[model samples]
Structures are given as C-alpha cells and as structure tokens.
Target: MFEHIDFNNLLATYGYLAVFIGCLLEGETILILGGVAAHQQALHLPLVIFWASLGGMLGDQALFWIGRYFGARLLPRLHRQQAAIERVTGLIHRHPLTSIFSVRFLYGMRLVGPMVIGASRLSPLRFSLMNLLGALVWAALFASAGYWAGQFLESLLGDLKPYRLPIAVGVVIVVGGIALARHLRAKAKEQHKA
Candidate 1:
C-alpha cells in the first residue's frame, strides 16, 4: 500500500485533482500534507488550494442537503453514535457557524458535523456560505503550513531534497497514524470512562 502511493510525485504531477479527491474523502491531513509538498516544488500551491477548497465545499454541500432531506429519518439509525449525533445537533442548535467550519479541524467531527447540520433544520444558503468560507480558510491554512514546513525543513536540514520523498512519507504516515491512534484511543477511553 505504501509503495504504491508516492506523495511527492503525485502531488507535484496532480495537485488539484489529488486535492479534490482528498477533500471528497474528507482527508484533511492529506490535503494539508499536499500543501507541504507544494512548498517542496513538487506541487503547485494555487492549484492545491483551489482543489482542496472546492472539494471541501462540495463535500459539505452534499452533507447539508443530506441533513436537510433525511435528517429526521436518519436520526433513529444513528443509535450507536447517538451522543455524537446529539452533539452535532446541539452544535447546529447553538453555534451553527462554528459547527459548520470548526468541525473541519476535528477528524471525526469533519464527517459528522456536516451530516448533523444536514440532519438539522439549518438553512441551506447559510450552510453553503459557511461551508465555502470555512473550506477556503482551512485550505489556505493547511496548504500554507505544508509549503512553509517544506521550506523550513529544507533550510533546517540543509539538504532535504535528497531524502525528501522518504522523509515526507515517513512523517505523513507516522504523524497521521499517531494522531489517528490517539483519537481512537481517546474515544475508547472516553467510552470506558463514561
């Protein structure tokens, strides 16, 4: 699996498309990592940002409609994850804007937040505007972080170009896996603690 996906080459060759797909899958980490790749000259910055933001908008837009259309019906089906569902519902009830945008920063929330909003009675137009703004800001932040990280790393190591791909993949896999594990572990702990 790892051998097949060449991060640097892929992002460099297919920045926007890759970003779009990443966003569609709610792969914010990959999107942000692509930004870092952009800094490496392996990818184009503007293209990365454009695709990522577009993907985010489309993904969230779809979710909003899902909520608007099937929210009530789906609520019962979400019995196992009722707490999370309710949290999102509360988010929609209380701070809809924060629910729409800030969820992008959260791994699990990214997927559920939009769906919850879609499930709620929030206005589609309002959701669209918030989703777009959030997606753009999120894309800019991650892309910039990725690009600058590349530059900073290059300067720090004095010659990261040679080991760039290996280093990048290593970092991506390690950090991403760690974060995921931590999230899962925390969730598990919460369940047990609760």
Candidate 2:
C-alpha cells in the first residue's frame, strides 16, 4: 500500500511540519529524518533547523507554563519522576541560567526539566530567552548530525536511491521500538513505586 509514496515529494511538502511537531516530544528521531531529507534535497536544512527550533521552544514553553500555573496541582502526580525533579531543582538552585540552558540536553531529563524550571522562582522572560537559545543549539546539533550521517552513507554507498526505503523504515522502527521500550519501562517503574 505504501509503495507509491514519493518520499522526496512527501518530505518536501510536510517535512517542516513534521519536524516542528516532532520536536515537541521525542524529536531527535524525527529531526534526524528531517536532516536526512535535507541531505536528499527533499527538505532544506536551514528551514528544518528553524522549524525544529520553533517547535522545541514552543513545546518547552507550554510545559513551562503548565508547571508555572499548575505545578502545585500537577507535581504530585509525577511521583515517578521525583528523582529527576529533585535533580533539576538542585540545578536551578545552584545555576539558574545554566540549568535552564542545558536541561534539554541532559539525558532522560528533556521533558521534565522544563516543567521543573517552570515551577521554580526563575523569571519567565529569563526562561524564555534561555530556552530559545537552547532550542536553537539542540536543533542545529541533532539536525546536523542527521545531515552528516547522510553524507557519510553516500560516501560509503555511492548512491542512496536504492536504499532510501529500507533506511527510512529502519530508522522509524528503531526509534519507535526505543520509545515504546522507554514508555513501558517508565510505566513499570511507576507501578513499582506505587
């Protein structure tokens, strides 16, 4: 059923939107795909980065707003992430700017860290500014990784025309599997904690 899909055309049309939405959650995988699309000339690298930055910044902002406005009511529900919350709290206390700037890069803390920061006493304007910078860096870094990866593959395999489908499928499956595994693990951990 999927054989007739023109990846290049599809990506060219919706790749930026995908990158934007994908950056909202587990974006690394999708952003990488965008980068690959850019390498394929199916998408533009700068636009890919732009959309990623916008989406990432807005997503974190929304989370931050939630934490700021509803943290008192919401935090208790996240007992499973207590350790992560505490770590983020400690970072905020010690280095507010650094914490806000680097939270997205920290392993396993990407989603929760912004919310934690939101719950803190840090200024919203400050958080917004820093979050923007962080998003830009994160987007550029990951998207570039994808772009270079395509280049590396091309150098090794000559032409990528024959391998696009397998590569795309493999990336999606691997990313999905990883996301599902993490979700299940976290769910089990929450249950165990309860």
Candidate 3:
C-alpha cells in the first residue's frame, strides 16, 4: 500500500479530503505535512488552502450542528477522555469565542471545540462565519510554515537523497518519543486524580 501510493500521488488524489478529515479529526501534523507536500509541487497551494479551509469549516459546522441539536449529550458522546473534556470546559468557560479560534492549536479541542460551543447555545451562523475565518487562518499558517520549513530542509539536505529516509526516521522517532512521554505524564496525572 505504501509503495502503491507515493507522497505526490497521495496528495494529488486525496489532499483535499485529507484536509477535511484532518480538521474533523483534529489531525494538525498530518495537515501540515500535506502543506509541505504542496510546497514540493505535489499539490497546488491555493487548492490546498481552499480544500483545507473548507474541510475545517465544514467539520466544525457539522460538529456545531450536532452540538446544537444534541446539547449536553454531545459532550458525553464526543469526548470520553476526562482530561480533554475538562480542559475544553475550562477553555469554554474562560473565553468563549477566543477559545473557539485558539483551541485550533490544541489537538483535542480542534475538533471538539465546535461541538462544545454548539452545545453551549452559540448561534450557528455566527459560529460558522468565525469557524470559516479560523480555518482559513489556521490552514494558511500551518501550510505556509510547513512549506517554508520543507524548503529550508531541502536546502540543508542538498544532494543528500540517500540520507533522507534516515533523517526522517530519526526525527519521527525523537518526536514520537517526546509525544509518548507527554501522553504518559498526562495519563499519570489522570490516574492520580482518580
């Protein structure tokens, strides 16, 4: 499967939908990587941004509507993870609209925020408008950042095609290790609270 779908082909085929699902599922790193691929000419920048922003907007809109219709039941169904629920609740309590846009940076809340807002009785039209704006901003930031970063990396790795896999693997391993550590720490905190 991996060999069948190379990066360029994958982006060309599913880049738009990937952005949508990424936003719906709160997959930022994946989305950013898409932007990196776009920078590599595997995808078109405007189309990438358009699709990403659209996906994000639609995902939030769907979640918001679900929240509006489902109300309190939405929270219990959407986020079973206690810590995430608590964090989102705290954010919503402290800063309604700000939390809506800002939480895009947070993996857990990126998808869940719209639902929570919907449950909280936020107006749908207003939320949709803001959500679209947020999606545009978020997609642009990550895509541009990833594109530039990939460019810098490419420059640094000039004529080093053979080392690409090793370097990529090393970076993934290091980042994955850090993520695992954070997950463990968060789990420990949750256990302590329990």
Which residue pairs overlap in candidate 1's backbone? 12-42, 36-146, 67-118, 67-119, 68-118
TM-score of each: 0.84, 0.88, 0.78
Give all candidate RMSDs, comma-separated. Answer: 3.0, 2.7, 3.4
Model 1 agreement with the true structure over 1-194: per-residue lDDT tens digits: 46566656665677677779888777566776777677776778888888898998898888778767887887678665566677777776788888887777765677667878877777788888888999999998888877887787878776655666676677678768987897888678668967
TM-score of 3: 0.78
Q: Candidates' lDDT values, in order?
A: 0.77, 0.87, 0.70
Query: Tens digit of lDDT per residue, candidate 2, span 52-129?
Result: 999999999998998898887887788768877888999999999999999988766888888889989589999999
- Candidate 3 lDDT: 0.70
Q: State in Å the error of residue 179, model 1.
A: 3.3
lDDT of 3 by residue, 108-139 (tens): 46656676788788667777777878888988
Pull out the clashing pairs in model 2: none
Residue 109's C-alpha lDDT in candidate 1? Answer: 71
**Model 1 residue-pair collision total:** 5
Clashes of 3: 0
Candidate 1: worst-modelled 10 consecutive residues by lDDT? 1-10
Model 3: how far is 143 from its true place, Å?
Answer: 0.9
Cα-based lDDT at residue 117, candidate 2: 90
